[model samples]
Target: MKILVIEDDRLIGDGIKAGLGKMGFSIDWFTDGKTGQAALAAASYDAVILDLSLPAMDGLDILRGWRQQGHDEPVLILTARDALEQRVTGLQQGADDYLCKPFALSEVAARLQALIRRRHGQLQPTLSHGAVTLDPGSHTATLNGEPLALKSRELALLQLFLLNAGRVLTRAQLEEKLYSWDHDVSSNAVEVHIHHLRKKLGSQFIRTVHGVGYTLGDS
Candidate 1:
């Protein structure tokens, strides 16, 4: 899923971006609220992590503008203000979830997962595609009732492919989901991962689209 994180603090932004990337979510971050608004106006995202205090524009205005324009995507408000009134206003203005400052990264992740689940109308924690299954809560996977031993990135990659089965996914799309913006990807990193997946799963699990990207094979 694609997420937009509007945070001003570099450390906090980077931490959230990295943590979510590891969980197989594509992330784009903006330090200022204007840029965040621009991003929201430009592209569709599964969810948004918005900070209340921001440069150029505040988080509340951003949320309000998005709603005014008929954007109904889930938004989790992140702020240092824990006042009751602030929470009410945030919720009243269309914040789906709220996280206070100094919060645990795990909590943020859990909330985001919940939002994505709601967006997709899925209440169950376990996701399946064909013979493969993934448990987001436990970070576990199995294929045909046998455990699928996979590295973290490999697992994330598989989950992404399974969720998007039969859809063509470009290298840029895969890399954005697997790695953070700051991480440099090797020229053949995606090819290497695809190779490993085919070896471990069935050879017919994936199909390469010459000169374009890849798609899941018809099983």
Candidate 2:
């Protein structure tokens, strides 16, 4: 899943990014609330990890702005403020969850998973598409009871497709999920990954929409 982390503390931000990245999440880290808000306006993300103490703009303002603009994406507030009032204020401002500082990365990861699952109306840990199954917690993929050996990038790409199955995703949309903003993407990167995916999962799994993009049928 794609996630945006808005934090000012370099150490905390980097730790969050690395920990979440290791969990197979596509993460974008922004140090200030302004940049994070801009990113939220520009792209689609599964969730946001926001720090209340921020430069340029406070996290509460950012959260308020997103809600005013009709952004219903799940948000998890992460801050050093542990006061009950602060937690109540954050919830009133539309945060889906909150985590105080000095917490476990494992708990943060688990909470993020729960948030995303709740957003998707899922009560389970694994995501399944027909006979294919992907376990985000285990970072494993299986097809018809057999393990599927996929490269890390291929797995990420396949996860994107499976999560948005039946939707025609353009190359640009696919790139957003498969590659980060810092990566130097060539014109053919999406095609290369799609080719690799088809080679492994069978061509019938993804359908090319002539001049449009690609989509997965209800297999």
Candidate 3:
């Protein structure tokens, strides 16, 4: 999944980026709230992790603006403000979930999973298409009831395909969803991942739409 994290503290930001990155998430982190908001406007993410205190703009104001603009991506408030009113206020401003500082990375990951799943109207913890099944909580995949060995990027790509089964996803969209801003992506990165997945999951698993993109094939 892709996530936008708006946090000012270097330690907290780095920790979130690193921790979440290892868990099969593409994360774009911005220290300033304005910059983060601009990033959100420019691109799409599965969810957002926002901090209340920020420079240039407060988190609540950012949330309000996004809601006003009809950007309904799920947002999880991550801040030090732990009072009852603060929590209620954050929720009222449109945050889907809330977490205080000094929190567990596992909890953050779990909450993000829930938010993204809820956004997609997916209640099950695992995503499946025919013989292929992926468990996001465990970061594991199975094919024909056998364990599937996939790299993180490959797993992410498969997850995207499973999420949008019949829809064609262009190369650009795949790239955007799989990579973060800081990475120096090669020209053939998306193709390389696609090739690897096709090799493992059978060549006919992903159908190529002529002059368009790719879509999940019949299992």
Off by over 4 Å in 2: none
> Which runs of model 1 end up more than 4 angstroms from their true locations?
18-27, 41-45, 70-72, 209-212
Per-residue lDDT over 1-219 for candidate 3, one digit per residue giving the tens place of the 0 to 100 score: 899999999999999999999999999999998899999889879999999999999999999999999999999999999999999999999999999999999999999988988888889999999899999888899999999999999999998999888899999899899999888899999889999999999999998998999999997
Q: Give the range where candidate 3 is weakest over 10 consecutive residues by summed lDDT.
A: 113-122
Give the worst 10-residue stretch by lDDT in candidate 1: 174-183
**Which model, 1 or 2, shows the larger lDDT?**
2
Q: Is candidate 2 or 3 superior in lDDT?
A: 3
Assess the local accuracy of residue 142 in candidate 3 as a C-alpha lDDT between 0 and 100.
95
lDDT (tens digit, per residue) of candidate 1 on 1-219: 678999999999999888877766668899999999988776667789999999999999999999999998899999998999999999999999998999887888778878877777668877777787777655678889899888777777776776676689999888766764556889899989999998988887788998889888875
Per-residue lDDT over 1-219 for candidate 2, one digit per residue giving the tens place of the 0 to 100 score: 778899999999899888877777778999988899999888888889999999999999999999999999999999999999999999999999999998898888778878877787777888788788887666789889799988777777777777676689998788887655776889998898888878877877778888889988568
Question: Candidates 2 and 3: which is better by TM-score?
Answer: 3
Model 3 residue 21 distance off true place after TM-score fit, in angstroms:
0.7
* Model 1 clash tally, residue pairs: 0
In model 1, which residue pairs have backbone atoms overlapping below 3 Å?
A: none
State the displacement of the C-alpha of residue 70, model 2, in Å, after optimal TM-score superposition. 0.2
Model 2 poorest 10 in a row by lDDT: 174-183
TM-score of 1: 0.82
